[model samples]
Target: MPDADNYGNPDYPAQLAEMARVLQLHRGPIAIASHVDADGDAVGSVLGLQRALRALGKPAQAFLRVPNYLAFLPEAGEVSPPRAQLEPGTLLVVLDVDSSDPLRVEGVAIPSGAELVLNLDHHGTNSRRADLSIVEPGKAATCQLVKELVDSLGVPWTADIATPVLLGLVTDTGSFRFMNTNGAVLRCAAELVEWGASLSWINNHLSQQPKSHYALLVSVLSSMEFHFSDLVVSAQINQAMLDSAGAGWEEAEAFVNTIRSAQGTELAVLFKDYGDNVKISLRSRGRVSAQAIAVACGGGGHHAAAGATLNLPYLEARATVLGKIEEQLQIDGLR
Candidate 1:
């Protein structure tokens, strides 16, 4: 089993110390990776730690591929795609993802030939083991854990290092608007800013979406759906919609957040139809558990946001998801 501890566990500092020691002792190349889809938190965590390791004269590479929207992050272009296999004796650090599942780790069938696999994440649902894992569900983002781990490594903070780390904090907290934006993470953000993290640059890039994004957003909004007396809302995007708007999944990824803002919505769903399967993203407000609904469908995430990919076709998946949400509503006595 992986050595695991929550942030408040008395042993947490010792665990971090040991992880730091492991990284320091490893002379082999270090490969950093995160979940697929390469959201801002994943991209930022990967890039930030990769730069920090390199600064320590450790051979580290970001084993992640990002979406176009995230490509603007500092050093994002330098990241390599996950390989079919890694060099022997490589230390593979998978961040912001459940490291126990190779499928979720992105790019590789399994991390073959890795000497050690370390999982650093903040997902409460993560249950599997890695060689070593520090899972803190209380954290606002994995970047917060990354910041602590980097501190343990004695790596001096720099703009290049701090910027990507801040990217994770900024985006994962929804630019500090999400519920996960706690005091500790806000303090971390302030420290990163002090270390020359370019907050304005990140905000500017994020705010400046392409025209296609607006087109795609418009289409998704037009597909507004309501269930359970407007307590639940949803929208969908299919390949047809993507083609019509000349947009991509990246453009549609955040649409769930849009629909979730509808007044008095308890739950919101964004369904991305891919003909044979549908990807479901869920967001919930107050006492409703989006993660529970997602977990029921074989997906995992935070209380407020989560997702799952269903093998069933769009209509079947839609029915199944709606059923799950209704069941959850009933359980919560909201129906």
Candidate 2:
């Protein structure tokens, strides 16, 4: 665990070390289940750990439940769902996912005597339900923790590992432009780069991937609607809008964050009717806790980014969410 030892000495608790020790015992086979979005952080992390697991001579596989069309990541062609040959006592390592949404764990049917459910993530709202949960909400990305966590397997960090790991760190930090970029993040970035992870290469794949064919950004901006007297900027995308663009739900993801990007905007909500129920995403660039808002609306996310699904129509969900935000603003003022 020398590589693990280097990142956080006394800062990392002994419990995390113990959790890593438990993961090492599953030497035969492992199943790595992760979110399907394959966002930079998610995909990069899956790749990093998958590469590492193979290097350790451990039979490992990466599984994604979602379809590939909506997941337009850089290495989408390379990632396929894992095979179903996982042994009865296989180790299940769940990464970058919060247990608040356990329904995502479908009928993989792990044995009752499964060795370990390694939950590794950096989300503040994590469930801590893993046999070993190493949650450092302060860290930039789960991929950062993943790199450190696998070091306990006695594997050294290399170019193969650093490339994918960098995807998570770079994107999660908003290309190192966000407030979360602290000394630890910078140090990890430097180390990963020195090991042959190219920042420009990663950014080019994500940031500079010509948006020419897609005019969804323009269409979204044209219809961008603001509420709360412009303090809150909101947007909604119906199925018709998706048809107009060459994209779908994932393209609309940038809307909520776009609202938060505006000057003087404090709250942003992006409503998308994704069948049966409407999916609501909340983003707050100010001191407000978007997580609390989402929890109120039956969703969960971090303080800045939160989401939930509402049974009501688009307008009702909007009013309900806005009312709650207003209530919080008043209560905050009363203090």
Candidate 3:
């Protein structure tokens, strides 16, 4: 029960093992720094790990770099940004994120001399900036990975613990609807539900079922254009869409998903004009790795979904992003 041996399969990557080593090395204070506005995946990872670390008598604190969607989860009151820098005996553990500049914590900073117990993500575009980076692209969600860690820790996976992680799993998998979702993900999500993760509540928050919620969708649909024999679909939005929907930048993060939701779109792109540059959002179905398309433009994410923000003028930036997608289309023989 000490390590992953206590859990179902201990899906412990070499990264988790390295985390234990760093814990032992410090054996005193440890800090868990994570992003806030934390979806189920992020909050779950932070909460589960913080609990495990504290159980070991390690001084662990969960830091939120941003405000969470408070209407959604409870990890908020229990969470707050941690003070910058690790204690002399503290080890810093960063989880479930891909940015080195994550948190953009205005006044917060990591101790320049602190040892990092990095739990790097397994995402294809993971930054792997931690001391012990745990990159497990093989796992469907970081929460699933954290659940493995929690199970191996030998403590019961109660609803309080499982709910947060389950939320993350559901969010990341698009409520078990994304193509990345496999039997393993379903099995994991089912277990979380069995462990008391509330699907009804999760669905209420996640599903874009509300008719009023379709404002952004309406905008995307109205602006959408088909290309490449209808295999490629694209849309362009200006700040006007957000103003119309009363959504801020965070709320519009899924703008491209709206475009991709169209039935016949094998590839979908949304170019949101930001004046100086455009935020390029890309999504693809089948074997279309949108991440590759974005990374080609110097951005990255999973194969089907990825994006990049360019500082160039709107038309020029849009041209560059579409050009990359065209290059990919030729490479994939979709053209």
Candidate 4:
């Protein structure tokens, strides 16, 4: 059984057992994929599972549209984009992906002959299309759930495995400062530390920004806007700004939190103009639902942190998203 403190469906153990059985019965290679943005939780979950399966003497490969900052992770060099050819009966496991839509996984198509699809995630908006899925929305991070699955499968705990799992928990919980941080989260962190996970190294690497990244942050902050008596704050980054700072989309991660930190701000938004589309990141300080706003804009994510891509000009996208946030605030009587 999963630890009582872990957040998951009551039947998680049974599902995990069945998955193990399937892996034991199959003789084909397993391919793991995750969301493209590849945050710490997403990357950690994918790499951690790959290591665990390999430790079990199973043939496994991992795939992701790798994020540059995460290249330091163990076996990260092995991560690749989805392959065009997969052998028949190959099992495809997707980790930490919030939506079943191919676009959500960065257009990674499921190969023609996959015997089974396993979706391991902690997103409430998951479409549940996998043959077997363990979606635990209450968990702080998918890596946290992955740790539970690893333990239930009796996989050996090694520093290689524990490091990534701890990375996921730390980043997803904002260094254990997010609202989801709970007793189980702390306990899991303590256990991982005991298993040789280095908290200081993880925190330093994640928090240390390059000079260019700080420049990008300055540009974004310079464009900040406030609305609804500063209850809703927004900042935008254009390709020009990114070029000036010599930065990319990954460098802009967590920049929205700066906006959210402003006093009286209940909702914060970061809009990144990616030429063809604008990616909108939403963050909330409890009074509004970021997930609701993202979903209304044809995107999905957690209640506190959500994102959507708008196929519109920068100004149009900003207006559309702000309109939705305002509507949600009105409905919730926050305006």
- Kindly list the per-residue Cα lDDT of model 2 for residues 225-281, writing each as its tens digit: 776667777777777778777666666665666666878777788888765668788
For 1-335, candidate 4 gives per-residue lDDT tens digits of 43464344678778878877776667888888788678899889888888888899988888776677777886636677766666677888888884356676742575335678888888889978888887888888998888887887688899888999999999898899888888888988899899988999888787777789888888888999999878998898888998999988788867887778888888999998887889999988877899999999999889989999999988888889988998999977898
Ranking by lDDT: 1, 4, 2, 3
Superposition error at 107 for model 1 (Å):
4.0
Best model per TM-score = 1
lDDT of 3 at 73: 64
> How does each model score on TM-score?
0.96, 0.85, 0.82, 0.94
lDDT head-to-head 2 vs 3, winner: 2
Candidate 3 lDDT over residue span 158-195, tens digit each? 77777777877787777778876877777777888898
lDDT of 4: 0.83
**Residues forming the 10-long window of minimal summed lDDT in candidate 3:** 1-10
lDDT of 1 by residue, 1-335 (tens): 32232546677788889999999999998988888788888988888888889999999888777888877885525788878888878898989888877768884446456889888899988774889988888888999889999999999999889998999999888899988887788888999999999899989988888788888988899999999899999999999999988998777888988999999889999999989989999988856899999999989999998999999999999999999999999988898
Candidate 2 regions with alpha-carbon error over 4 angstroms = 1-11, 65-78, 82-86, 104-113, 208-213
Q: Which regions of candidate 3 are displaced past 4 Å?
A: 1-15, 20-26, 35-40, 51-58, 65-70, 82-88, 99-113, 127-129, 208-214
How good is model 3 by TM-score?
0.82
Model 1 residue 154 lDDT score: 96
Model 3: how far is 153 from its true place, Å?
Answer: 2.3
Error of 2 at 171 (Å): 1.6
